[model samples]
Target: MTEYATGLVYPNGIAADEVNKVLFVADFTGLHILDLVTGKQSWLSDGGGTYLNGIDGLYYYKGTLIGIQDSGNQGDRVVRFYCLLFNVDR
Candidate 1:
């Protein structure tokens, strides 16, 4: 198999949106969205905060990107990320 991505530290969970032709990946480097058609991958930010701590699980449901992250000293919890709020280009 050929490698399709880089900069991922311990990739854990994956969620795919076939209709949108995208894959949301969770890794120690944070979260990223991959365009299946163009082969473009972009890192997703948590709005300029340290809220994202090496996501361990991910889910793409409807229009939301939900993830389970290890908050470090804050413990682990599930978070819902609204793509529109971040102005992510599809």
Candidate 2:
């Protein structure tokens, strides 16, 4: 298996910009960026920590990556807008 991002547990799928060739991986833990040509990897975000710590369904729309998350808030059905690249791994 290829390691796209570190500390990313349970990555489901990936999307990319065909023009740019930048790869984006989806994980219940967070999002990871992989360079197609350089083979370099980087962490994108934790999706406001609402990913249930391990879930599924990763999609991209209008240059935005959207996914469902639990956020430790059970019994409540709420959706919140989150900033992309909130937590960048160094």
Using alpha carbons, what is the TM-score of model 2? 0.53
Which residue runs does candidate 2 get wrong by more than 4 Å? 1-8, 18-20, 46-55, 70-90
lDDT of 1 by residue, 1-90 (tens): 845578877889888873767778888777877777677788877667657656788888877888887767288888888765433345
Question: Which runs in model 1 stand beyond 4 Å of their true positions?
Answer: 18-20, 71-73, 85-90
Q: Candidate 1 — what's its lDDT?
A: 0.75
Q: After superposition, how far is residue 32 of candidate 1 from its true place, in Å?
A: 1.1
Global Cα RMSD, each model: 2.7, 5.6
Report the number of the highest-lDDT candidate. 1
Clashes by residue pair, model 2: 50-69
lDDT of 2 at 54: 36
Score residue 12 of candidate 1 by CA lDDT.
92
